[model samples]
Target: MFVPFLIMLREGLEAALIVSLIASYLKRTQRGRWIGVMWIGVLLAAALCLGLGIFINETTGEFPQKEQELFEGIVAVIAVVILTWMVFLDAQSVAQRQSTTGAGSR
Candidate 1:
């Protein structure tokens, strides 16, 4: 229960950060008018994720114990993969930024 809540909270905040940054940048640059499509896409993604979660929960509950275990394992592996990728990408981005800034000061 807590795990799901925390995971969802973290993931939601991560996504929200990206959207907020884009929105803020747009406003700062006076291109805020184009934010409508970005907001719409974000809303659509949220809706799709919610719908998919509900469908997965309902469908998983309909399975037998063994099948449920298998499903849980698969979902866990997928989550691990996603988390790993996100962390790797974040580190790579940060490294690139540092390198670029270092080179620029030369």
Candidate 2:
């Protein structure tokens, strides 16, 4: 559904931002040569994510109707927990950055 699509889009953007930040830091620190290694790591991570998604999809499709419903409910609860944790971490990061920039003093 559109909800899952939006969730995936947001997660993908978050991942892209994280990778860009790491690459920027490496470049700024004159570690440009390690960029290839970083790319390799990124590719491996993406592959692993894709593999996991496919595995889950296949496994869940084999479940009986009642079990499938239960599995989905569990997955939804876990997703909510993970999303809440991500929001908390983001807020903490923002707070830390603001404090370091003396924005909190104002």
Q: What ranges in model 1 sit over 4 Å off?
A: 1-42, 53-61, 103-106
Report clashes for each candidate as comma-separated counts. 0, 0
Local accuracy of candidate 1 as per-residue lDDT tens digits, 1-106: 9998997797677777667766765674468898998899998998999898799788764678898789878977876686667666555655675686764421
The models' CA-based lDDT, in order, is: 0.73, 0.75
Q: Candidate 2: global Cα-lDDT?
A: 0.75
RMSD in angstroms between candidate 2 and the native structure over all alpha carbons: 5.7
Candidate 1 CA-lDDT value? 0.73
Per-model TM against the reference: 0.52, 0.55
lDDT of 2 by residue, 29-106 (tens): 568999999999999999998998799888865778899789888977876676567666556655776777767532
Listing every candidate in turn, what is its Cα RMSD in Å to the true structure after a full C-alpha superposition? 5.5, 5.7
